[model samples]
Target: MPVAPAASLRSVRTLRGPGPLGAQVPGSGGAYWARLLPLLAALACVTRLPSFRWPLWSPDEGYLAVQARILAHGGELYETVVDRKPPLVPWLYEGSFALFGDSSLLPLKVLAVTAQLLTAVLLASLARRRWGDGAGRTAGVLYLLISIGLNPQDAQAATFEIFMLPCTAAAMWCADRRRWGAAGVAVACALLAKQTGGAVLLPVAWLLWRDGASRRCVARIAAGLCGPVLAAALLTTPSGFVFWTVTGSGAYASFTGSELHVLGRGLVNALVLAGACAGIVPPVVRVLRVARTGAPELWLWLASSAAAVLLGFHFFGHYYLQLMPPLALLGTAALQILPRERTARAIVATGCSCAVFLAWGFLAPRPDLAHAARLAEAVESRTGPKDKVLVWGIHPETYWLADRAPASRYLTAGLLTNYSGGRNGPQVGEKYAVGGTWPVFREELRRHPPTLVIDDSRGKPYGPDRVPSLRRILAEGYRPVLRVEGAVVYARVGRGGEGEGAVRGG
Candidate 1:
């Protein structure tokens, strides 16, 4: 592509008059990227897709994918294979698997990238409504930078937060337009993505109610909120939806998400995000100072979403992913509010351009996923397609790569023990003893009896003496067959069990 001259960039400064600082031609005539900033931002997202040829970094990625794999093959969600989250994320994974097949990471990457790009577009449009063209473009660019750089561990995966963003952005945009009905529907869809999405409804509803919307409009908004929720509820048996999404949810978060133990761990993550937003802090303050700010709902959104970032109790990277939208808006305003002097604006734009480049360049590397392939190698040596295996830890990637069914339906033992520790939120009652469905886990193990068990030590915290039956089952029924990457494997003693020996690597 031919490089446009530096002067061309100046033409993007949209103005009230049809002069030099006005709109340019539609074609690729110098300042094309400026006019098509949103479109370009989306395409940039697509082009900047992460390298999929690595091992999965976050356990949640594999966990959700495994659930999707199960669902794709006709297994039930909460009843058969379990997770405490709402059903939307896994369903999207299910859809991707149907389209791209479950074997490659490409499907998940594609799904995440597409959703992220759409979010960028919506976010930019929303910023433009409240700010201006400069802020809109700036928001789009900053969101892309911060999202991809936020948490290298979870950023690349098709995380629930990633999917929720477009819905949240759309809802905020609709509310900005006083399209109360559309905003309500958008937030309902957001809830389907992840429960944190429910927070978005606060800002939307507050705006509608504060604006003195007509009673008919209020009813329309309420109907939109109820419609999607009711439809999603009808998809599952009423009992299951109530139990998993609500009851089980409270149990799950109580321990894993809301526990104080995770606070210290998350503090660093919060700092990192804050540092990333450092450039925009000044502008954010400035934008807020204006009494008649166009995007008044942003303050409420910031309050709700920022509160959500803290409420989850856990400091997981993806949890912080919830803060991107508000940060992007504020950051965009910061970028746009610079001095109108040509030299000052030019210098600021140049600095921002370099910042985006530096962030993308530096944050592109992923965690070593190569070891997972090795584990898959060693695992496939001992198991086959029909044979079930227990990831006695948190490495669900093993199950995905080996193409085997999870012997224990729960993702990790941590979830099970969470309830016992009183860290249990709503879901991990006696049913999902740890982090999953405990009774079903035990039944699955006893009835099917996995051919091999990969004793992932992550699930090792037996917690206040651990479950005695589980200890006995492992001690008497399974024997250690191998060890790899600090993960030990225990093969079922009688069901095509291997001799007592350890193969160091797969």
Candidate 2:
């Protein structure tokens, strides 16, 4: 027989290392854990790396980027920019702007990736402390892979959750180890990062109590929870109050009593949650079955903590992303009970597959991109610097690309009519109605008239539902300039015998 080639042997050697297929390899040692970390991290970076240049910023991201630009230009951090998010996210974006100066999306996305990696590392360490190196490495690999696959919205650079997640994980780990002071500081930093950080506090408190800590210890934990608030106050008291009180309250309040538009969105979120629990539950059941009860209290604390956070709010899908790290650890610990390799492998494979789908969805092509880009280009080609642009029934992504000032209104009648709620206000004829019967929007538009109006046909008011408003605008002397894809741009036209000044487009 011919001798096997050296290159083929080298390929075999590489495959035996901790790559994706390495899980099938038989041996376990320090070398395995050592090789696993960088391999997982590299995989995490490679999967999400393409999203850095995708160029289609979501509405929230576009608005945050605009806010960041304002901050970089020495504008007031909070007051001048009126987004509902806490200041931390915008501050991060502003920092990116300062460093990269509109270079690419990498700076922003890299920040999130880095935070995710830290979360994975912390989770691994936490797993090792509670279980063993094998369990810890498994949890770490699971976290890195799942997080990449889940593609949490904050998976992007300016994500507040990404920053807050690691802090929360660290706090849980510290609390589990009875390191109260470190846990407190970590929780405090989490709170400073985002309001959702507050949800984990009660869970931490419960963990401390279960650890046989005295009532006095609980009080100290409460004080540590307060530390983040105090730190935030040191920066600016009123802003800090606004952060916790106004912004926090308003964000949650907005979610209640509103019918979600895309039914698919909620379904996808539920599937992801179910998938995460699937990874966690079998292991947990197996552990309980085996009755290996050392540190049962810790597992109970973590489960209760996760449940408390999940139950406390009506959060969107991304909100649940933070729960994955702790859940994965708890799941892996539970897996210790099952001596059967086949069952464990199946569970891990199922969880990993679900995660991959979630991550892929985040960077996938959205139908909104084409319409948004066309609207942006249309406005940019026509409008002067002195003119402003108002997008109705559309998100801020379009305006972000237009390089023109956006109107200050939160939502338009067009948006309300097209989206979740139907038109509830005064009719501007049949097709359009003001959302709250607020003529103030129309008055504001007339007072500082926009040079062009770009209406997205596929957006809202499908077919005859849009005609009345288009006609009313035409009656008021606006002429159609250009129509591209589903978008139509209208420019102001002079009335008969009227001076050129009568036309706003000029």
lDDT agreement with native, every candidate: 0.65, 0.58
Q: Write the per-residue lDDT of candidate 2 for residues 1-506, one digit (tens) a residue.
A: 33245633432332122321112334564676678678668756754564564664355676676667656766664344444445667777888888898434568778777787778877777666555566667777667655633443434334666688888888877776677877888887777676667666665776676566687777777677676667555654466357534543332333333334323444666566666455556656644544444344345445544553454234445555666776676566555544548346745675577556655655466566666777787788777765676565445667667766654343333332333222212322332332232354455566776666655544444322555543564457566656667565666675232213322321
TM for every model, in the order presented, reads 0.82, 0.72
Candidate 2 C-alpha error for residue 285, in Å: 3.6
Can you tell me which runs of candidate 2 are displaced by over 4 Å?
1-36, 149-158, 211-224, 230-267, 276-280, 288-315, 340-363, 384-387, 409-484, 488-506
As a TM-score, model 2 comes out at 0.72
Supply candidate 2's per-residue lDDT for 252.
Answer: 30
lDDT of 1 by residue, 242-270 (tens): 67777765544554433455675577777
Q: Model 1 segments beyond 4 Å from truth?
A: 1-34, 37-39, 46-48, 51-55, 255-261, 286-294, 334-338, 341-368, 419-436, 458-460, 463-465, 497-506
Clashing pairs in 2: 108-157, 149-355, 149-359
